[model samples]
Target: MKLDNLYIKDDTRNPTLSFKDRASAVGIAKAKELKKDVIVASSTGNAASSISGFAASAGIKNYIFVPKTAPEAKVTQLLVFGSTVFLVDGTYDEAFELCFKAAERFGWYNRSCAINPYLVEGKKTVAFEILEQLNFKVPDYVVMAVGDGCSISGAYKGFVEFYKLGLVDKIPKMIGVQSEKSNPVTRAFNKNTYEFDYIPPTTIADSISVGIPRNGIKALKAVAESGGFMIDVSDEEIIESIRILASNSGIFGEPAGVTGFAGVRKLKKLGLLKKEDIVVTVVTGSGLKDLKTAQ
Candidate 1:
């Protein structure tokens, strides 16, 4: 609450109530351009819903596969948006695998992040919006949650694009946050190891409980090139962050959504953040998607 020059990129304001909308919007447009009438994707919840929402509005058919354990609210969102939802019996990674094969079998346009490079292109828009929102002033640090790592990678890509175009003086140091239960990227970063070890995810932040991040390599490169790092927080810390974000900033966000803010606190504690440092953290999803967990 007392931090100075801290900014929240409230992506929950998007129509689908998550940052996934941004990537899905671009994916949908690409599908249209390619004349692909059927779109397929997989998610723990938010990505599926976002893609379905956009595809519905565009009059495209969308099929989404999610883990059976996905939040009820997100499942309802997919159903209400008219997407064919597949509740896979296995984990999110399993759902993603199924969606991949199904998309190939059905010849549907795949909107999976990292699997579909265009999704990252779509997400990079967040960086442009952030810079423009701040009148082209680059922040000292940019932070966000990492799951498949597409979102953070996309943001990094956006900064690179802007820098190439001479639109910004410099890119901010990127910080990626992950749950301790799903901390592949963080562990790799801490150990200077790029190889990923897939582990069973056991976090209440289901949206980011990625065992094997599809974009791990790109994400590592992004952080390395940007002179940034990754860190992790416990589920308890993430829950506390959700509470702090809401109480202090009046922005209610899901556990994964508020993970970046949790990273901010971690950085603050480690003396990595200074009072004059301008920081922006992405609030990736609405708390409404997992209201029960918040309680």
Candidate 2:
């Protein structure tokens, strides 16, 4: 469906409630080849649930580390999937460090975004699906929220690869959105520097409140190469985006999912967008993943 100068589609049935299934789908395939026993990953929400779901399907044990600040709905989803959960008193970055040490100590397969190259393989499929569904026609822009940047990077890679394979004629520009308070990437992009000092705990956007994005450097490259722009949106704008997406497009997405729309709105207000422009903004997760934020 089309909404707000962008095309929106639902990716709700990938066994997990969020789009991280695409990452886990490929991670599981690689794990079998490595003959790994345990799968370890760090997530604020959907990635943890997805890893647990896929691990069970592949008969592998799963360990998930998450910040204590994560939303309850996401924590509950991971619990219901029977993942071995570790709640860290520190931030998401600290939880990532602990998971990294554990993975190295136990030789567990790592599905974390920054450390795992194959994780992006699964996420790339979403872009492939979009292009094929459009019958080889490429859009002018593809928008998505940037957390670790894995998903946006994956989608951009998919578009370029598909173009090389004669599946599509061209690659679309990528528009990346990050939470204003927690947006290291957007800060870096504007400053043209690699140094970014993260702020303290924030309730602005829980799904994207990481102090430091592990894949900051690569995520910047994705935006630069795709001829795309990155912007930050306020918590207020994100809340409004959630309502607008659900009401206008018949899609119930979390704040992170609709933040891309918030960015698109920024472009339109700046007179950088047109009504006839074919754009795609990804709904990264179901609204049920964060009911409190949705409400």
For each of the candidates, give the backbone clash count.
0, 0
Query: Residue 285 of candidate 2: its Cα lDDT?
Result: 83
Error of 2 at 43 (Å): 0.6
Clashing residue pairs in candidate 2 are none
TM-score of each: 0.98, 0.95
Q: Where does candidate 2 have its weakest 10-residue lDDT segment?
A: 1-10
The digit string of per-residue lDDT tens for model 2 on 71-135 reads 89888877877889999998888999999999999999999988998888888899889987877
Q: What is the lDDT of residue 210 in candidate 2?
A: 74
Q: What is the lDDT of candidate 1?
A: 0.93
Q: What is the C-alpha lDDT profile of model 1 across 212-243, one tens digit per residue?
A: 98898788888889999888888999999999
Scored by lDDT, the top model is 1
